[model samples]
Target: MTYTALNKQVQSPLTEQDKRIIATIIQRHADEIKTLWIDCGITVWVQLQDGGRLAFDRNWFAQRVAEEKTSLEAQENLHRQNQRLEAELKQACTEYGLQHGEIDYLMFSTKVYRGRDLVGFVGFHRFSQMWTYSRRATEPDRYARSASDALAKLGVRQLTMV
Candidate 1:
């Protein structure tokens, strides 16, 4: 089965306080090495290179960072894995023919590599009320999965033909 993302259950723009909090979250993530993918409502998805998804509560993120800091080796390995995962994530997006606008929300999927060779991945998908619809959202099943399906078939075709 394939993944289908969710749209907003309500229509609402972010409040001033919400913007501030969002900005802080963005800024904090921006300073780090993590990459962030943002899905605004069900209408727009933007991949931010400077920051990872900011959908988490501030304290939770802080706690994670603190825990990570306790082990220097782990932190280094994690950073390496993040770098590899960033590339693989981009590749998956391309291979699957997914546009940045198609994502419903942010997912922090980590990729691991060994000596420039990618190994595996893990992901954190955030489902929260952070974005408003910039435009009316189309039905989630309508368009998003088509590209992924087509791409998969295309891959099989190429492999078989080769």
Candidate 2:
């Protein structure tokens, strides 16, 4: 049945069990609930301090619980992958004798280093939708290429040395 049509069936007020289920779903899927509501045209209302009532679609709540579970699973998988990449990056840095400071800056900050020395800074070029490493325009390409390769192993992509 359509949601609009089902909305008129106020005779069957939500039971205590239904309220419990809804509360559980909301707590478990707080992150995905907003997008789910917009996508499914689900409405939610809450009672104010004075006197009012809250309404929402039970079907939508159920669907959101399922979808949020799937979404959270995917996110967990991605997080695992990222963790693996981070470990690999750490090992690579150790083997290459690269300083941890350089790695940290590359991963977390916009500062760019030239062979263990901070040469310049990097910025995202909005027009090109790519990162621009600014400094040492005449330097050999090998250093930049090596740095890019290291970052690539850490799941960083589309970095421009220029």
Candidate 3:
């Protein structure tokens, strides 16, 4: 709706594309988006074509991010557990010589969401490398050689998620 003053100062002028994205975010996530933006200390504000200004807080955005991180961890844990159980079941089927169906390796996309709104998604394959590099960066001793080797082999592509 209506905002009198931007909670934080925005240096860049909002573009039409930004407006569209914000409108989509607001429409899709509603209160969660507002809360997350406010929590994260990020600004989403625009001077409209009609000359009215809209503003939102960054801290609110962070809340959504935090929630999403929690959700992702939970989902990943559940998925790993399910995979383990499936493997056990498959082993049993093999022992009995039963016709076991194909075991599909479920690859999920790591979605970047602002609350319920999906801003982007990184596929499982992409995320795996991301995890590897990030792990190497943080824990240098464990992956130093492998990380450097990967970087040598893949160059910048090793760091890119897209």
Candidate 4:
């Protein structure tokens, strides 16, 4: 089956406090790689309606640094490997494999709430790498079979796919 993302259950621009919190979250994530995927550079925390902004600050213009500095040949090889893996996935699940126009940025959507009211939105984050693959989300559905019961303990209703 295909995935459909959720629109906001509430509407309004983020309050100053919300902005500050988001900023702090970004600053905190930069140095301390918490959760690897959820709070890292690749994990973009975009709001739902009309699209949104990053929860973390991405250095819009940063020269290649230490670990990230790679030669062109290595980059090309990685690109080819990713392409091969993507083709394999498409062949495995043809129906959901083709994303017409969507960027299909790897992500997961979680309800945002403040004082029991839905407010902050959870966004799609990377599982690993900065890969821009869509079908990757199917992995979460597989996890849901076990995660749902545990999430229910945290008061979550269900694990929705995107």
lDDT of each: 0.36, 0.43, 0.38, 0.34
Ranking by TM-score: 2, 3, 1, 4
lDDT by residue for model 2 over 1-162, one digit each (tens)? Answer: 887565444324444444434446555322222112222346554322234344667566558657756776776775665455445445544454333333232232244433567544333233343434444444322222333453443333343334
Which predicted model would earn the best TM-score? 2
Order of the predicted models by lDDT, top scorer first: 2, 3, 1, 4
Better of 1 and 2 by TM-score: 2
Provide the global lDDT of candidate 2 against the true structure.
Answer: 0.43
Candidate 1 per-residue lDDT over residues 1-162, each given as its tens digit: 222323232324554443333345445332332232234433222223353333544455455545544664565766765555445445644553332322211343333233354332323222331111111123121111222232342231212222
Off by over 4 Å in 4: 1-70, 95-162
Q: Candidates' TM-scores?
A: 0.23, 0.36, 0.32, 0.21
Top candidate when judged by lDDT against the true structure: 2
| Model 1 spans > 4 angstroms off | 1-70, 100-107, 110-162
The root-mean-square deviation over C-alpha atoms between each candidate and the true structure, in angstroms, is 22.6, 11.9, 18.1, 23.2
- Which has the higher lDDT value, candidate number 1 or candidate number 4? 1
Between candidates 3 and 4, the one scoring higher on lDDT is 3
The alpha-carbon lDDT assigned to residue 153 of candidate 3 equals: 26
Model 4 worst lDDT run, 10 consecutive residues: 141-150
